[model samples]
Target: MTLMKAVTFRDFGGPEMLQLTEVARPEPGPSDVLIRIHAAGICYHDVLSRAGKIPRDKPGQILGHEIAGEIAAVGSNVSPDRIGERVVIYQRLFCGQCPYCLAGRQDLCRNSRVLGENGGGGYAEFTCVPAQNAIQMPDGLDMTTAALAVCPIGTSVRAALGVAKIGPGDKVLVTGSGGGLGLHQIQVAKSVNAHVIAVTSSDEKVDVIKQAGADEVIISPDLKFSREVWRLTAKQGVDVVLENVVTNTFGESLRSTAQNAKVVVLGNIGTRPVEVDPGLLIVRRIRIAGSGNATYADVRRSLHLLATGAVKPFIGRVLPFPDVGQGHALMEQKAVVGRVVLSGW
Candidate 1:
């Protein structure tokens, strides 16, 4: 049995629970590819999982999803020549024969599971995933940038375009606009020529939010930004609201939307519940859709936009693999301006 260095926590608690240890290297199954992980992004979701907020992400599971690497080997069923291709992982495990997967909605597959739950994850030097999940990174896209291709970027694609159907002349609002997903979602909405209004809880992030292509930035540390949204849209409200921080902002997001507008909820970082007024939802005719993860097509679109520079990844920091605990602290404190990617294992 070959051994590889990996970061995994035997018990769920704080970032310190994540320890460096040796584990058996995973071998690819018949339809899988062995990936030599070059870089991996630290997502807020990882922090939540580490705190035991997610029941499915079991203890001892390697916790990372935003991955980029080169194929180091292949299973018997895979072509040997493809071993050297650079790729970004698709971020989910799914039964391919499911109806949703067949229709390209892999995120909605009946058997869908996050990669680290039952398989090797990107925190390690190597991981094995289905061949179809290894999306080829476009030429000139660095490993760090490609590491974010399927996550903050691809999920942005799903929220802005796939769910909200944002288009030219649309009024789009993005909450948590200073964070990793927020900055990318703003850029994705702008890529399609939408009018974007960004909201951030941190006053220090206003300029960075603006730099990420938000037409307007509102600093509301207390989640009191709906009135400002009303003022900004001239009482018309926004056509779409991308709610990345849904715990405290769900109500605000619903209030920030126009009649017939779609509100796409990407996450509730706190894992806490928020009260909602059904009457307000009814009167506004607001359609709230929950979105997470990305399909193969969404990842492909994300890569194209990234490769062409239509959307630039906001990489705030890059730490060596051993500094992953610091990355978790930064994410938990919401201290980073954008994505934190880990490499140099």
Candidate 2:
């Protein structure tokens, strides 16, 4: 009956709904490992969960998906060697018996239970998870940076490599290029030797995106911006457009992509219906795809890339665990430059 401090929300609303409370520490099962959470990266999905945008089957749920910590204890059947090892957690817990899991696509498992959505999440002093979801952290990686591996880096890995199959010399345009995932997408594209054009809404993020290895950066949602993308590519447009914005930016992304190029939509920040000409898809042969959370392979590859120093994550600010509501407020206001991590639980 040991008690641990955790952030919880009973009825979904705004940041005010988030509350700090003491809860029972979870006991690890035979194949589970208990972790002392060092940091939890706040994401937009967490905001949506708090606002009731993402449905919750139960009440008083804790809401943080991206987590990084050290293994504190393990079940009797688990290996003792893992204790005290630093690790990044994979948010999605899948049923190994599902067809999707059998095909190595555990991200799409029908019965999958995401960490924050299913039960106890990372916004706690302690969390218990399956040993399979624990990924070893390389030396020199800190908790704040490790927390991003599960969401931002993992999503970029899934979209850029797993779905888009972006290759060397590929011309890629990343919309919403100033945000957490956008910056990671730029790094991932650069790692593959792709020429990256980052599109953002403010001039403030221009230099930031450029320093992250973007070949070019543009202010978004302007037809002139599309023209600039074409001009940069010698009027041929880009091979792939990472469309994370949901408003007119989506259409602009579609317009900026080269003939037969692919557009991968990952976010719904704008969250509005868009109009598209059917002829554009029919004649230009553009492909539109949706990507979600990372697979086990994606998580491993992302961590490996992070370990190799290929992807350096931009951490905006770190708030104390008790101030998770303030962190959420910063996120809602779009006040952060990169990932916002919560620490000192």
Candidate 3:
């Protein structure tokens, strides 16, 4: 059996749990493809998995979801042309036979399994994924940007376009606008020619948030920015609110939206309970939607945007594979501005 270096953890804990060691290189099964990972983007979900917030079937799991690489080998059922092609792996594992999968809504498939939570993830030199999940990379795209194209970019596409139904001339407000998802979401909103108002707790991130195409940047240390948003829109409020900080900013997000507006909830960073007023929802007529995972179509659209230079990838730090733990630490501390990618695996 051939061995490859992987970052593995036996018990769910903190950054100290991550261990760099040799593990058996996975072989491609029928209808699967073995990829030599060139770059793996770090996400908050990976941090949650390491902290035991996300469940695992067993111990000793390689944890990473955002991945981009070259197809080293293919299964018997896959085409030979796929070999040596650079590609990005769609993070969700879904059963293609399901109804949702047939409808191109694999993000909602009942038989879905998340990459890092299911089995071997992208924290290794080599990983095997379903052949359908391997999307061919465009000519000018690099592996690092390709890895970020899916989640921060593609997922944001789904949330802004598909879920929120953002349109031209609409006013969109994005909370937690300094992080990976928040920064990309601002650009996604701008792609539709919408007026984007970005909110962040850190003053140091205001310049980068503005650089990411936010029409208005709000530095709110108290996580209360609805009044500022109201003032920015001349008291009418925004048409859409991309709610990234659910726990800290949910109530304010509702308050920041216009009447009959859509509020798309990405994820809860605080992971705590929130108190919402029923009267507020009744009066504002706000629709609260929970965005699911990104689909193949979403990934393709985002890649096109990136290839055409309409959107740029934000790589805050590129760390060697051996320093994976350090990447997690920086992410935990919220020191890094954008995506943290691991290379040289």
Candidate 4:
């Protein structure tokens, strides 16, 4: 039997639960491809899973969703020509029969199962994924950076383009602009010709975001941030606000958005609920949307954007697969400036 090393958690709590173990390598089904994972990107969802905040019925769970690798083998019915192709994978697997799938909203499919949560995942030497989920990585792109093409880039594509519909001359605001997702959000927003205003917690991130095409970068939650954004936009609030850290800056986001603006909430690392005043919604007629994972179409579009150099993913560091605990700790401490990538086989 072929064996591979994988990181898994027997009990959910802290990073300590992440352990390296040897497991039987999976065999691909007729429509699946076996990938030898070169790199995987760590996401907050992985931390949420380890902390049991995401909720799982099973005890042992392998965790990693943003995956990129070379095709090692193809199943019997698959085209052998695809073997050896470098690719990034879409993490969400939907049952094709679902109504959401028919509507091109596979991200919201009723029978959707996410990699690293619904079953075995990419923190391993090998993983079996549907051929449809494997997208060809552009030539010359680093595998480490391509690993991020799935989750962070794809999510930003969905939020900025699919949900918010940001376009040329649009003024966009992104909260948590120093973080992984925030950085990509800035790039995606700019790709649509929008003028991006990034909100972070520190001055160090200001330059980082500026380099990523943010027209203005503000230290978030400071009274001066809203003022700076207002001044930059000539006292008119931004057209769209991408709110990720809900607990820390939800109210600030509400204040920074213009009347009839769209605010998309993606994540809440602070773990606190956001309290909204009804008047703000009623008077401003602002739209607030909750965005989850990206659909397969969104992932495909993101890959194309990356291929064209329209979006660049900044990878902060690469950690050994077994040291996933340390990686999670780095994220918890906010020490990473961009996406933290993990390497396996």
lDDT of each: 0.91, 0.88, 0.90, 0.86
Across 280-316, the per-residue lDDT of candidate 3 in tens digits comes to 8899898889996888899999999899988898889
RMSD of each: 1.0, 1.6, 1.0, 1.7
- Top-scoring candidate (lDDT): 1
Instruction: Order the candidate numbers by lDDT, best to worst.
Output: 1, 3, 2, 4
Name the better of 3 and 4 by TM-score. 3
Ten residues in a row with the worst lDDT in model 3? 50-59
TM-score of 4: 0.95
Residue ranges of candidate 4 with Cα displaced over 4 Å: 57-59, 221-224
Error of 4 at 30 (Å): 2.5
Alpha-carbon deviation at 157 in model 2, angstroms: 0.8
TM-score for each prediction? 0.98, 0.96, 0.98, 0.95
Q: How much lDDT does candidate 4 score?
A: 0.86
- Write out the backbone clash pairs for model 2: none
Tens-digit lDDT string for candidate 4 (114-186): 9988657888999998888888987988888889887899999999999999999999999888889999999
lDDT score at residue 341, model 2, on the 0-100 scale = 94
Give the worst 10-residue stretch by lDDT in candidate 4: 219-228
